[model samples]
Target: MPMRLFNIVYITILCLFSTFVIGQTLEILPPKNITTVQVFNPQKNDNTAIIRLGSNEYLLFLFDDLEAGYKRYNYKIEHRNADWSESNIFESEYVVGLNNDYVRTYKNSFNTYKKFTNYQIQFPNKDMNVKLGGNYLLKVYTTNEDQPIFTKRFAVYQGNVDVGMKSSRYINPTYKDINQRIQTVISSGSQNLTETPDGGKLFIMKNNNWNEHIADINPDFTRSNQLTYNNVEWTFEGGGEYNWFDTKNLDVPGLTTERNFRKDSVYHTVLRVDFPKYNLPYDDYGDVNGNFYIRNNRFGNEYLAASEADYSWVYFALDAFEDQNGLYEPYVVGAFNNWEISPQSKLKYNPVSKLWENEYFLKQGYYNYQYVVVNTKNKRVEPSYVSGSFWQTENLYQGLFYYRPWGGRYDILMGYGEVNTRN
Candidate 1:
């Protein structure tokens, strides 16, 4: 990364003040529940990690990089003046665990398809702690001599979930909104996909809620696209919850094991984003005047799962009313940005009402996103993506744990991620 880029990210961390708290960062969070993963190297010693306002529980992490092995990290929030300084409350080195024998086979050109042998590395049993305040960091390394391989940033609330008790913030993170749909539904499809020699083939709702081009995606890198819905007014409220249900709730065996503790499993609303249908069908497949997505990484634990690759794609539509330059504006946000609405994906404003429009092509699966206004006053936000929700891809989120430490049962959450819509 360039010095300027690093500087820009840290600068934004300082500026992330949330209406709910002292401040916040808008980055995608990691999957809250993951049991199995393949890390590249772990035999070596001296892997250190750092934290800002540390916690008293197990590690709070963004889903690690599958390619590079976990620890690519999120900046989160601002504290102690919001600078990366020591007083900022959070910052430190980390002790990360790795599963070395995660690969199934090595398909080298030499006709050697060897199963990745198990190196017998172990996961941690205790919670990692960084006892301070303000914004902090976690840096994990192989050894003092090795370069820091994995990095994560988090904010310590010093409080609990019971604190935010209004507008569904405690349970769902997003609350009332102008564009919120009276009712919304979402589901997932598959993760292990076979790419056609021609293109990708992701399954989505029969309706045009997703992109036709998405069927052709087969990338190592992924992105989180919000699931559109109603009653979601995420205009700078520091932190919130986003719950994505698994498809098993729809009753497809072997696809999922999640059962609703309550009969209404689909009633759970996690994230939202714009759908292709928002625009009249005349637009080009590669055009959007304004649109974007947002994330919650600045705060603790909130992250983009599976490295933003295997998750749902976030889509937004800019104002067609904007000028020809509308497509050139910002239409996306979330943890991907440093938190602020970015110019790189801005919505090009229409000359009619001078409103802008934009769109995003995200990965398939489920997610939570905010429909922002972009301007400082956040005056340009849209509610269609917020309130007018839709259902797209249907993927299964399976959580398996090696509880015995060596060879325990792989416990998948019963009603953990079953995605569905309300009756």
Candidate 2:
């Protein structure tokens, strides 16, 4: 086999195996009874939870459970290495307090149909504090079971280094409409710090989606405590703005919703089939950066899923001229599924309607989604074709710097920063 083909095959195998292992171990979510899971830095409205070590910043974890009352939910923190696998350090070694803590903050939903309890927890609290700065996973489960029902990954960085990044037009003319380039510079704040080009790892992600992450990026050069990464490899497809629909109320259809009705006490919604006009001029309206906001219109300022949400079967349709053939398959990508492309988000082509159709049982809320084409041949996903790409499209970009010395046991999150296309 050709070297490039062999490498692609190897990476595909590794990704598949890694996904399988994570499905069995991490189990980021349970089968049912949970909804609207969000873990973010309270300081920002976006889904970024990466925070500075020992800072006042905290990660807020919230989820809704389908119950009128509370369940004995508890959480435990685990340390992770650069690969997101369990680190060699024990729980006691990283946590200053107890490893397990009960979720004491919860509220019952107010006036909505599907009763539920909203559970929330703020990390690095008085009872539990982080002692190590690196990757950490928050595992939540019932008190009776040892297995976790769900897990959230977050990072704590020491900020020992500085990160500066810029977004610009891609140099390649062939991809000018479809790609945007990012150039980054990292410099150590202290003179004693040293980062070898091979020992340092750079991770770049778009819109806070973990699955959309670019990992193991190497720098172009190193000078003392400074490193620069500038290459076409840093370019990402400038996916178009998200398509949104609000189902905040079952009685009324939201924008972009074609129709909504109730049958046999079950709610149904049909979204207007999207036919993106790529030739049209680029128009920039603000968006949630491909995130979903769970709320019911029945109660103002109350986003509690238990009393505020109504479950409904939302049918989505994409007007496509022909069946996606050869290497690429289409999927509905959004925060609903952690922006992960899977069978659940895959769309089926309907020949009679000439559209790609899919349905998801979603809670009543405002949702932002986009159509993404997945290249089956190389396991690469791109939204540029399905959704028009534009340089002006607002996007959140994150830069994570990981460093490990010659004899260090694990990679430390030395620095983290965010830049955007708008600013």
Candidate 3:
């Protein structure tokens, strides 16, 4: 090839690589001052950020900034493919109105030792409305510098197809006792999924954890307008039920709280020490399936909890023998931290106390969490290593079906369904 032609191709490849890198790294970093970020449907009072396409309902995004004062923050919405990657379609093709807008609603904390400001915004507002039904990313940033502080993922579905899900523990012998398999069937009605060059894709998620999900799953067979997915790969660890703690009332110690006290003009809470359940028999204590909710029991009105609740430095300690050898690192995982294993969630071993301890500044609420071990050599996270896997453990499984024609620019969310293992 000519020198000029070679140079042009090289530059094009470099630009494409740069764009891909930026897209991949955008969701990893979040500002340190941001805390308790939540996106959910207010009407349902749950943490799942899913809504029906063209419905009157909306998802509310809420967060607290430790900076304690008002700051100008803007949010931009971007449509994503079924794999959570940037779609090729333009913003106008997926968004009905403005793609970006300022967050106009905020409130200051009242009667709290730690002063902070809470910010919230509702989707499908006056300035912006999503036109497409698929995966979406909400990017929150500072308006002045255009610097992104955090990003969240949500979904909208047309419900054009019906999805049926069944979860069982009768997998192969190797995983039959420790894994739960999800079998799904999608009814496409008059739509023929096989007509497209690439048929529909299925994604399964456990307990609404986006970071750990099974994606790009194809159907095993299709017939009579029905697609089935019963592959052996559709299995997840049946990790034990989450450990919980309640801090809805600072004056009174909750079930899992060892004690609550005040020091240095601030509040602190010590949770009861936790232990590894790998050797213990399965216990069926009902839980919220690794989810959390903010509430102040002292206040009669539940709505006031958002602004009136106080912050406390909650201490967590683990008395596990597996991590004593230092082969693995232990970190507390839950919805409170967006289910991401970060430095904030890592626990440090105390030589004198012989325990792994960490403290988190959290608002008054009820939280569900579990201890996870990270292999030092391979960096593999094992949820069942400390929590103990059980075939009888209850779990929530969700499935999403996406379809796109051969020439379509983006994937369409055709069906969504969820099932509880023992419900």
Candidate 4:
């Protein structure tokens, strides 16, 4: 194993074990009732992004080469509910594919012969597929094509991490036996290694990236035997004292992040949104992500969510927001939006708003999210998530991660941060 590979495995194990996604291939499964066509992978561009949420893994992918388009391009995920299949987003409850809500379909494509990326969309609900943490296949079909197209089976894993980490190295008659019980995880736990109680040392191997995050190393404490052997880098997640090397690693509070930079600064308009409880029937009457969105175009005391781990979504209705001519679709823009806007992540129009609105599910951390409109052709866009509203509401945020090392049990670690209006 290479050092980086060990780091990834260690960190992967330290973070969480997802047996479902590990090394699983995408394949075509059947027993179905939908029209199909020629489906295959070019071996190279068969790119896929698998996400593990809770106990389930969601795959977001795109496919290409459609001869034509249709009024309704309905797709279905076919699978069976068995005795050991764990759980399904829809299973063992009632009839399958009962309605559109359980299924996600795209109607009327702007389909063209031009090269398009992110062309595939799949919502592999637990029913159409099993959550057994293994590899499965995907079959593609079209209202136009005839035979079901076969795909390479991709792996979906549900592996988690180990916990039970206590102190390491105890040499003495009193706490020697006691220390061994904490997590005598290493292959070697001989007494010769322990020179003294405080001097005696024990070690825990963490995956690369599985780091000393949130908590910093105690300055007064020193680190020995911190080196690499074989392909693995053996070090500590950090310890000694409590708050030694702590200055908010990875992410600070009230901050935002994005993969693409669509614009410069995303406008965030904070609102006093009351999620209709009893008397209310819908959302965003004053909702930002709502259809009947209150159109405010300013910034506010917008600090962070009450919880530190909230990256807000920016929703805006599109009503001639811009010229509908471009390679990119306009989605609500914000710092989370990465500033760029066009078609890939654009918002759909809502008749109720009499405008168009887009929604984004942000990372569970801090930062202001705002409404942004973009023109893919000109590449011009505007953001305003922070705007006008009589009601003032701010958000505080927190982050928590659970993980276990490979071959060992696991535990959960909760980290907190405060991201206000400050950078």
lDDT at position 253, candidate 2:
80
Residue 166's lDDT within candidate 1 is 16
lDDT of each: 0.24, 0.74, 0.79, 0.26
lDDT of 2 by residue, 1-423 (tens): 122111122234225322324433653554467866887565765578788988889888888787659888899888877657667776777789888889999888765555678888888899998877788888898864467888877889988888888988765565555467788999885733454437787778888776565677767877778889896656776778888988988888877898999887678999988875466677787788888766777654433443457778899998753335657777787877666566777888887887889998787878899887666776665566667777778888888888777777777888998889878
For model 1, state the Cα shift of residue 358 in Å. 6.4
List residue ranges in candidate 3 displaced over 4 A: 1-23, 144-146, 171-173, 300-302
- Candidate 3 lDDT by residue in tens digits, 1-423: 112111122122213221212346435346668988888677877888888898888998989998999998998987888877788788879898788788898999988888889999899898899877899888898863245788888999988888899998754565433467789999976778778856588877888876556776768888757899987666777889999999888989998999999898788999999998988999999898898888888784535777888888999999965764777888887888876666777889899999999888888998999987766654556678788888788898888889986778789998899999996
For TM-score, candidate 1 versus 3, the one ahead is 3
TM-score-superior candidate, 2 or 3: 3
Distance (Å) between predicted and true CA of 416, model 2?
A: 1.3
What's the lDDT of the predicted structure labeled candidate 1? 0.24
Best model per lDDT: 3
Which regions of candidate 4 fall more than 4 Å away from where they truly are? 1-48, 53-57, 71-104, 107-120, 125-129, 142-147, 162-423
Clashes of each: 124, 2, 0, 89
Which predicted model would earn the best TM-score? 3
